[model samples]
Target: MLAAIAAVAALIVIGLIIGFVRGRKKQGLPQEPPPPPPEALREDRPKITVDAEPEPTQPLQLEDLVPRPPEAPAAEARVTPPPAPPADLGAFRSGLKSTRGNLISRLAGVFRPGRELDTSILDEVEEVLITADVGVHTAGRILEALRTQMNGGQLSSVDDAWGAIREEARNILASGGQGLAIDQTPTVILVVGVNGVGKTTTIGKLASRFDRQGKTLLLGAGDTFRAAAVTQLEVWGRRVGCEVVKGKDRADPGSVIFDAIEKAKDDGIDIVIADTAGRLHTKVPLMDELKKLGRTVEKALGRPADHVLLVLDATTGQNAIQQAQLFKDALPLSGIVLTKLDGTAKGGVILGIVDQHKVPIEFIGVGEKVEDLKPFSADAFLEALFESPDALDPSEEAATAS
Candidate 1:
């Protein structure tokens, strides 16, 4: 019994030692919990994708294209100017060579481009014109026109300003605005002027004009006092295919006119141009004889001298103006016929006559030939005065407004 008890005690002790070692090992084994579900593991972890998210963007601006502009006009950009005829484009008259000599001289002086005109020079121009037989009133107005042009920035040069004066004179002459009216009855042109003013020559030329116009023409040698008068009228009458009435070198002038006009009316003549004895302005009695002759024609024939053509010598200068004034006062002068224009340096007499007498220039005798008489034109007269018209003129003539 005692041996058995010792063996059992040894076994018990060994078993106890083994159990303690196992407990310690288990405590060191890191206390691992039981395994969780697979779904719970996926829910707790992070996720990844194949494509990543993009970042932010930006914007645009201005100074990006061309540099400058183009040169010429386009193909469709053409314009048209106006027509240029019947315009005051520098055409000259052949006849103004006579009746407008003084105007020519004055215009020449004004067109020479060197001198400058102030009030003093203007006053000199006035004095020169007035001395040349342009009346005081006309001279004053012309100078005033120049002064006004100077003040208005128009008449810049001395040479150019006279055109304005010339243009003004043209306006005055054109004031006698009646055109030559042809009547059914005979048109009688009675020639009157101071001696040496080309009266007889003008009568012949006038008769030629009428004859050339295909009219029946008649002439009267009314200046019977002059010894050569009858012969001269007969010469002109023959030259123009005209019939003439004359006296025995010293018959009453009135009786001769009466016979001529009566014969013209009887013969169905279209015009009768009568040559009167040239008289001085001082001869009032001789002029009264003309008035008495006028009365006789009025009584004998229905047509008196319908047109009293005053023949003037353009070279006569201021004397022409004086003559124009006297003749206009004495007779109902219809128009002026200027003669003896060749070789005249001073042509201002035309302006003076126009200014003083207020008469229109009807014809100009440029030469001794009958065909030398030319119809009066203000524009042509202007060009004659200026020589060349395109040289910076102020006379644009109210046209260029369009």
Candidate 2:
């Protein structure tokens, strides 16, 4: 009975083991991780890529390895300086040839190798001075100084006489006051003169000088009576790159100048140069007209014109003194512009003008050239006037000799 019972238990255990194995098969458990999804196993599936580097067609050169310079600009875009113009006239010595020759020759003629100095010698010198247009007053003063020197035994030779005269000229020139007072902004310059005294040319040259100084300038064509005058001033304005304020033909000059000053004030110009009609000082009506213009300038500027420059022809000689005196009486003539000095032997008239009227010579026109119109330098004028031919440059000496 024990043996039979044992056999049945064994059978039950075996049946239990087989039933467990069959239950696992029905669930279908994977043996490893099961093969990947069928879609992932296809040949066209996305894959990671690692590309090889590209090879150059040719070997590199040293220049190719180095960075290249930037390309040059085109020909049309290039900038070049303009060619130079004709040379300018330089030095006062050359310009004073005529005056120097005339005065120096006459003075030199008086001093021969053995000419004795006497009272009659004084008379001859005085005559030469007067003939040179040194006014009676200036010549008298120069002679008086020489006589005092001679009495004091200071003048021993003709050389002493020459020295005395030179000293007197130096004193007279030094007495003239300082140069143009450009102390104010928009320095108003009123240029007045009789007809044909080079007023237009002087104004043009002045504009050139101011332009070179880099100052902003305005020109007033106050000579509205003459259409040519306005046109000429416009030409100068264009050349100097300055603006010109003008009015209709025969417009009131005072109105034109007033407008110019107003414009200059509005534009903040550095200078205002006004051109006045050429009117004779002897004419009462004309003189009154200038006086009215002066009033207009003062009203517009809130002050008197900075410079009332009287332009006179140096060739007018003593007549220039009369003109200067009359103009001084009519207006506050601050300075004088002596033109055509190179064309005349009467440059000595400068001495006379200074003696008669204390107005300083502002500028002197020694030639027709713009550069020839230079600021008056007393020392330079005397030096050039009395400079011996030997002391001058070859060109100046040649000019004087001629």
Candidate 3:
């Protein structure tokens, strides 16, 4: 009887627990919510493009966005500028030819770069330029510049030596070239050289250059003595689509210059390039004429020949040095334009002229075509001089038609 009573008590307790659980569920209490886990979120992002092709809109690719390289500076040298034909190969034409020939020969001979430019080689270079008629002070300056580099333990290989010399020469030449700037209104470029130096040809070519620049110009036949000078300038002017102003062959050069200026002003022309007669050796009368021309133009144009570019024939060798000195002394010569390089052998004389006068070679005439004028680049020139004729700057030919 006692055992049966204990069993009944256990059953009652189990029933009471079951009833409590059912009542909570019915009351709408969240059925024992599950325990939460880890969490995260999501969105969109962009990317950079580098190199993409021109396919309309392929959603610019990353590879298509590289920056473009900058253009090279005008005189930035890859090698050498080509040789120019000698313009005023007057007295030393044969000698100039010889120098140019030697350059060709040396260039053919494995490009010695001049015996490693040892003290001996440098001295030889100095002597070569001096012998070619470069002035003493100018030669000394070049030598000293080289000497300084050597003393400073800078020059070693032939390339380095040449580079050092070239750098110094270029710097000096650059200095002289920079000061004589061109003008905007009635820009005047006075070209003066002794007779038969291709002055007229240069003028024609120069006029053509301005024509391309959209510069309205008038060519003044200041060269009255040469029988064909005025006509030649006229031919070039016609070819280039410009105007020419002339007086009788014996007319005063100063008066001719003034008249040209007056006409240019009246017509609103942009430039007046005067082609002065090829004044020959110590012609005091002609020199006076040039001086008078300068003064008269200053009065009329408000600017004397802004640029007096001296024309030298490379074939003239040492005489080129003398001519440079004469012209430089006679007029405030602005720069030099060398011609006849394509036909002559005395190209080294160019360096001598630079060494002597500190004049930057502004242009070089390489051929007979009107386009054959090129700007000078020291590095390219040196390379050509040291390298083969094949190494000559292509622009030398390119300028032949410009």
Candidate 4:
């Protein structure tokens, strides 16, 4: 067994040596070459030199870094528009529509197309003027002027006759076309009228007119005989941004006016429009009261009332003239405020009142609007009354003709 073990061990050793030799031969046999170095492994490897320094970079500015949008153009200056002219004349013309038809149209008929100026035509003209509430004296004066023009060989054609009449009427109204002279500070205007003659409304409208003119105004509700008069004045005061100085029921009008003037003086008011009891012109007690009220206003201001505007109802015709005369006799009236002029065909009463009383017609209440109480202009009045279609501009004439 020992011998078999030795021989087996020898064979095992020879086999192990042979196996080792075979492994060695296999290892020694040529294999695939080892991979190249890491630098040489890349196909696009760059050649690098170690001597050169890198270039410096610049910092970016706000204007250069990103793309910018284009600039916008400068703005242009703005223009202002012009102011509008006053429309009082146009309003006056519109208000005189009735008068124009009643008086002007009748006069125009007398001087129809080619009618010659004759005494008969003059008589008819006098009748028309009188019928239109132009008082007998005023009509006669106008007729005398017309007859004088005729005697002087000036009134030949119907146009001449119309021109003469207009000239005479204009001359009569021109003197009384003066506006209320409100030159004083806190100008006092004591408005007096008969009952039912729109006395309060006239005061309201007048206040509105003065307010629109940028004048600081105060109203005096001196007509304490009527409670509505006080409230009405208050309403107007609010409407026109004026303060109203009122009295108790049936308070003395003069005392109310005195308080109003004192208040106006204190408040730096530009005007004080005082209302008075609307009394009958012929009523002695009431007229004396108005005279006392006027004196009170004078006493308060240390001067006569700047204006004693007699508010007359134009629709009353010649009765208006009579009323105005009575009021003139009672109070020192500066001017007249003709109300309801739009309601009357007897607007010719304006001519009569001015011609007879010699008192200026300061304002005419043409319509119910506040602005309708226009500052009286004789030229505007005459133009509105007598401006024929032939007086229109060519463009307007063409339009009319068409």
Question: Which lDDT tens digits does candidate 3 get at residues 266-344?
Answer: 8888988899887674777767777777788889878667788888876676677788887887788888988877655
Superposed Cα deviation of residue 82, candidate 3 (Å): 18
Better of 2 and 3 by lDDT: 2
Which of the two, 2 or 4, has more lDDT? Answer: 4
Ranking by TM-score: 4, 2, 1, 3
lDDT computed for candidate 3: 0.66
Any residue pairs clashing in model 4, and if so which?
none
3 versus 4: better TM-score goes to: 4
If candidate 3 were superposed on the true structure by all CA atoms, what would the RMSD be?
21.8
Q: Provide backbone clash counts, one per model.
A: 8, 0, 42, 0
Q: What is the C-alpha RMSD of each candidate to the true structure, in Å?
A: 38.7, 23.9, 21.8, 26.4
TM-score, prediction 3:
0.64
Candidate 4, residues 1-402, lDDT tens digits: the string is: 999999999999999999987887788754343454566434345644435544333344343554545432221111111221343678667767677767777777788887766888888999889988888999999999988888898767888888889999888987864567678888998888999888888888877767666788999998888898899888777777678999889988888889999999988888999888876677789888987887888899999998888999888989999998888888888888888878567788889999999998888888776656777878878888787944434432222100
Off by over 4 Å in 1: 1-117, 127-135, 152-163, 176-179, 389-402
Question: Between 1 and 4, whose TM-score is larger?
Answer: 4
Show model 2 residue runs off by greater than 4 Å: 1-90, 389-402
Those runs of model 4 whose alpha carbons end farther than 4 Å from true positions after fitting are 1-87, 389-402
How many angstroms is residue 50 displaced in model 3 relative to the true structure, after the best TM-score fit?
A: 70
Please, what is the whole-model Cα lDDT of each candidate in the order they appear?
A: 0.67, 0.78, 0.66, 0.80
